[model samples]
Target: MNDYTGFPAAARHLAAMIRCPSVTPDTAGTLDYLEKVLAPLGFNCQRVTFSEAGTADVDNLYARLGSGSPHLMFAGHTDVVPAGEEAAWALPPFGAEVKDGVMYGRGAVDMKGGIACFIAAVEAYLEKHGKPDGSVSFLITGDEEGPSVNGTDKLLQWAAGKGERWDASIVGEPSNPEAIGDMIKNGRRGSLSGRITVHGVQGHSAYPHLADNPVRGLMDLLDALLATPFDEETDHFQPTNMEVTTVDVGNPAVNVIPADATAGFNIRFNDTWDGDSLKAEILSRLEKGAKASRIRHGKDAPVNYSVDWVGRVSPVFLTRETELVGKLSAAIADVTGRTPELSTGGGTSDARFIKDYCPVVEFGLIGQTMHQVDERIALSDLDTLTAVYLRFLEGWFSGH
Candidate 1:
């Protein structure tokens, strides 16, 4: 058992984990390193590899301690996005360099740091209290930064098949934008993506009735979707907004009308809507616009089109019923002297999947630099987060 009191050791462990370069499908021994640290704490660890027919395989880990109900799971991802322009970093992105009072690395703030602190806190708690009265488990995946095809979603199913159940979960994503104690994510907005393709007859641009312009139809359909706001501010969420991310005609000659036009979009919506209802609404708007435009364009204009929903439909969720959120919030206030605002305003995370199984919330270090050029987290924040986790464990299991 290494010294849990030494925060330096925990930071060093995090640095070493970052150096593994475990980017998505290529774990590169990251899980092996984690097992080395966790096995000593009496965790029954297993590495589960999952694969979809057309997609690459992904490696994930499920480690549990204790064997009873009220199981608390800590979830996170060890994989990080590719470090672009590594030379621009003051320290190597994978160097895990600690300079001054902060640690610099690719996964420092996005994650990995949170995992390190939680492991250390749990180790300290076990050293003091022996085995916990309730179970503690870690649900870590390597595909979160990638396609998310074979990650927590599958691992949760695997654990459940083995008769594993969770009372609550905490995703160790960096939730606080300013400081560790400033925010706690009690919910997340749902996400939906879509693409629209408009088909038209190709012809010379100068010809009056020779061709139909698909780009015009696409522009009108896009206008219809964006013209009307999806919803005003809801109680637990912000107003839903959609953006056109890409528009492609693929025509090289300026004088020729493209045969087809394509546009891609995404929506971040609140709990006021679900995937089905939202999809219907979008389709209705597009259909209304397409029909009207086609009628107006008549036989000479090109207006044939199709719309497809792309990617997963992220469902909105809130964790108000769970004691984990309250306990962790109180613990944050106790340790940092700041009351965290329970919020759900952020991009989607793996919490979207975990929410279906157990009440889940997200809290970790400040996230100002996550996925940015030079990611870093202050050493003081690590200590504060560890203390918060320790207090939360005591308060939660003690039934406080």
Candidate 2:
């Protein structure tokens, strides 16, 4: 039997990447460091940069080893959210400092650790079984924490244009809530964000009869939106939820009624509906509520408002592919001695974009400290996750 000592520790690679501070929308030498690491592992690396009109340009890395059927692609993001204040953390966020068997850094668990472990596993596999029986690729992006306009979604298209076909994929997105093997995201809830604007005439607050008060219209519209439940529950998902994120008038004067009022909301939904169906449902509710949106007590006319869908709409998806789900579950069980739950409870991820091409699941390190003030991950857990990934790679390629 091959032992775990065949390759260097995963933490070494993780620390190297953490020191780069690859903040969202900025390469910041992260791609450079990753390419240098991957090239030595026999991967042909490509750095693809994508740009949208308003969003900042993002650089992504795609690397592949071998070219054959049953290609297994590992996807993740190298960019991390800002670390707030360096003085507030026990160790400097970009220092990658180790203390008492733990490593502290911004992307420690959210997840440069997952990336490191997967790479180490691949190295261990090569040291044990020679070149992989199938192909392996890395789809690392730098725009996951930003607007996500030009990261994995574009890299996938760029790769597809170059004739890359993937059989299955695993996104390392810190799927585990508490423990490394506790959860695997077989699917994700869809996300729909929209803005509701109510236009009214500006006037003096004392002369309420002459001018419409947009604030009243805004409250009524938002109430109608929140009054009803989107859905009770789905077979594999939680109930659909809507949260009103912000309501703004941007008016400072207390005596003047703002001419316009706007409210923003985001909905996390399930496979019982798609983007179109969910959007229609929301609009239907808004229209029905608009009838009661009266600025004046005697006014019976419905509110004049519009709904604008923001950015791209992610459709809810569930992976019913038995081969992909079964083998991944079995591999996690074999390594962790605990069966992983197939869950679809998190926010939207690049997996939504990946699902359009091939079946993708998510598994990674525990994320208790992700994006927190003093983010860190245990070194011992890092070793254990490396073993888990190594087992999965072997089992996946074994044609089971």
Give the best candidate by TM-score.
Answer: 2
Pull out the clashing pairs in model 2.
Answer: none
Q: What CA RMSD would you report for each candidate? A: 2.6, 3.2
Off by over 4 Å in 2: 1-8
Candidate 1's clash total is 0
Q: lDDT of candidate 1?
A: 0.87
Model 2: per-residue lDDT, tens digit, 177-207? 8787899999999899999999888999898
* Cα-based lDDT at residue 151, candidate 2: 97
